[model samples]
Target: MATLRQTITNALLMTAVVSMATPVTAQDCATPGQWLTPGNQHAEAQPPMGWDRLARQRVVLLGEQHDQAAHHRWQLSTITALHSRQADMAIGLEMLPRKVQPALDQWVAGELDESQLLDRTQWYRYWGRDAERYLPILRFARDHRLPLIALNVTPEQRRELSDPASHQWTLDQRHGVPVPLAASARYRQRLMESFEQHSSEQLSSHISEAFIRAQLVWDSSMAAALANASHQHSLVVAILGLGHVQYADGVPHQLTRYGISDVTGLMPMAAADACLAPTGVADALFIAEPDAPSADTPRLGINVERTPQPLGPDRLVITAISPDSPAQYAGLEEGDQVVAIAGHEVRDTAQVRALMARSLPGSLIPVEVLRAGERRQQLVTLPSPSP
Candidate 1:
């Protein structure tokens, strides 16, 4: 089975757009699967407290991959459901920096157009440029007059934290706010393990420390904002990245330390594979209708790291060949300058990728390369990408 982490990433980072036009009803979503520890048993005939229990909590965290359209739909629906039950709630967003809180206020007050709201917030610079993607949630907030709070430190603050001099408590602390809490030992270790996945650079103490520092401050700040907003009879719902909601390792941990005791975490699990043996991932793993999975891109099955050729026109050279790959079988080797395929010039890796997307398995690709100062050509069969 795919890990919960991988499943969420696939939904979040897939290349194809799974567009959503309207909010998804709870009826439209997959019934959430419970992730219980092995040997744990419930005494009640009925299952545990569901969304209503969540509504009664002081703080409710709806974790999302942010880029997934369906995740946004789930968020909107959940917020609407909570509102219908007369839950006094305000939503904090991970997208905008605290500097743009006024812009959010103006928009919620109906003083700004969608285009103007994005501009005032400097959307692409701070969050992202896709305003239409979040219109559903924004519209809901405006319609209901719910507070839309900005939930991040400024970009300048982020840059300062990255500086070596900013490590001191006084230099980094936000005025009047508590200093950001350090991540627990387990959280730091997990963060480093994740950092190692996408980073090609050799892991070093410095890299890990810097990344952990930034992440702690991020989670801590968001946690502080949510805690402050959580007043008597008020429930604060935070929309955040999936990584920040794992177990009690993230925002929940920080909030707990700050004395916000009652917090619940909910993760969305798409409908097709909703029910499974408990992974013990969160309070609940609900599902949304999956977007159409994107068509697989054809591959040459090569692990060649691209290197830039700088003397003249920018070009790419193969740093290495993947084992058991078409390129290796066809005699492509390290340090070979990739020149073309099937008479089309290979200006860069993107061109090759574009070509491969059109190729089928068993299709012969005539690859040209410069190896050991001499030009050579080989006909290599394309391969299907791994499932």
Candidate 2:
């Protein structure tokens, strides 16, 4: 009944209203549950391309930023997906030393419960990260009766290899680990850059060599473990730090020397990184939405490193303090030795973190710092850590 001009105007008005009401989709790379190639190319044509590639590989490495809950979630989901297709799969973990293999075996065999397994593995002593973040993966392996492989060397072995003196040791004295393959030039350069970023300028200059060797030893040990596991299982999935998986230069490099070439590496990228094109960091990157900040997670906001002294004990030194943090508010400064936290004597940064994890939000904990030969105690109010 309306004129042609009026009908056309109404249709245009409706189209504009509908478009406005519809949600604007996020960029494809940033979209949750999507997979992007190492070159940041969309793999939408084959939704299962990532999974198919993983299924065909002998080893799959899933990397994570230790503190990011979202990274861990992606790892579990990927593991779950791979496991559904590969029942003969095994999981290799960098969280536990080879000394705890018995514990892992017992855990999967239903001989030990969660707490008992942690105790036997000395979880708090070696791995100080939140155990809850990794427990779900362990539980999955247990429920499915999959073998959990311990892929890390003992801390003592790591320390021995980190020293320049270990370079002279024979095969027998090297704790059964072979001499590591020479690092690629790119790998060495990346390690140097990382060392500078994490260490103080003075510490960086003096300890760079040792630090680089330590990382190499870590990579070599894990690769050896994975190689051994690969021979026994249809597939092996390795969960480790992102540094070891990125660019395939860390563990992947060592794996090749161990005769493992069918390896794929995957990592989770934050949505904020969606705009940047990737470059061979991993085989595929999953876009993970950042987790909502937790109000209950206590944060002290300080960077610390344990320096082994020739004397009584290792000193836990504050290397940097975040601005407006509890450490800064409580007058803690760089070079201040953290003698105690929550009234307990602390020997390493791990112990400090363990002690802090016990406190709740709004709790006032006492911290003792020795500054220039003077011991001072301050009460610090804990706050939620930034997401």
Candidate 3:
């Protein structure tokens, strides 16, 4: 079986990180256009040549590298520009799942403040990336009274779809998510290359098939949400991770299946990759300098959620762990229930963040976890702070 990091990297390979090209080899992707600007330095001063093209589309997707504050800023600026010409618009978010959409609606209706929305949505529990980076965009939507549409399926839904055995469920039982259209031959080959990039065998057909199924489930779910929301609003602008928008193979392809064809995808390209961008990566690209790591908060590079225990209060279970992270290096795997950190019991992600933030780099923090009903202990060595 492929590791979680390998799976994630395979998914990300189709994202804006590599311009969603065929493969990473230098020979596969074509060179980027020289006429386009590279970074956000001049973004406010002047819009790109095809800026109006985005406003004309019924749906415009703005892609981002989830952790990059600069990408968010670019998205905000692009959104501000699009809203000027188009008054009737709704913003779709991939961050919050459909279940928490009521919270989003309440936020837009002026019934909730920032803290209230965060609490109601369980923002930290669901989307553990820095909420501060996304608050500005959320505030913009709220202030303008723009309809905020949740464009993602629940984690539970994704888990069900990942299991091939669960194919017995009908469309109604699958929460109305259609059976994903078969992936294009080209798209499948690209995904196959992604799996190979993760040090897996070059011909791992089973892993590729599973990975493609997972990707299809996500793309189709979000596409269905956006397609339905687009009918009510003149324009729907979706803020999603680059992977979903890249090369128009993911969500875009799925959207066409839903009869929503007038769409555009705008991806933010790092300045360093300006010349390396592949053709047709996105409808538009904004050059932005990459953001530096956060100095204020230390990271364990793990996403966790609180799980109700039949016998105990609640357990913090690791949902995902980033590749090459301190947690991964320490042998922490997903499904491990975090018991304690630094001798302090951890009940929530916020507490874990607080404890991790206070510890200096290189400090060996003792961690206790429960794996498969067995208690295990590990010490995580934090990497030195980014220079």
- For all predicted structures, in order, the TM-scores are 0.63, 0.71, 0.71
lDDT of 2 by residue, 1-387 (tens): 124223322221122122112232445445767767755555442233557677778999998777778888888988898987888999999888988899999999999998678768877667767677899999999999999999988767877876778778986687656667777787777666555444433543445566667778888889989999999999999999877887888889999887789999887765445335457767777777667664565878888888877777668888999999988998889998888888776665665666676678778899898899899998898874455
Each prediction's RMSD over C-alphas, in Å, is 11.8, 15.5, 7.6
Instruction: Give Cα-based local distance difference scores for all models.
Output: 0.66, 0.75, 0.76
Q: List runs of model 2 lying over 4 Å from the truth.
A: 1-28, 43-48, 168-172, 203-206, 296-387
Q: Which 10 residues in a row give candidate 1 its minimum summed lDDT?
A: 12-21
For residues 46-148, could you state the per-residue lDDT of candidate 1 as single tens digits? 1245557777788888877665677788788878877876557898997777888899999989999875776577665465434555788998888888888
- Per-residue error (Å), model 2, residue 234: 1.0
TM-score of 1: 0.63
Clashes of each: 2, 0, 3
> Which 10-residue window of candidate 3 scores lowest in summed lDDT?
26-35
Query: What RMSD value applies to candidate 3?
Result: 7.6
CA shift of 118, model 3, Å: 2.2
Q: For residues 169-235, write the lDDT of model 3, one tens digit per residue.
A: 8888888777787787766766655555655455556666777787788888889899989889889
| List of clashing residue pairs for candidate 1 | 269-286, 269-287
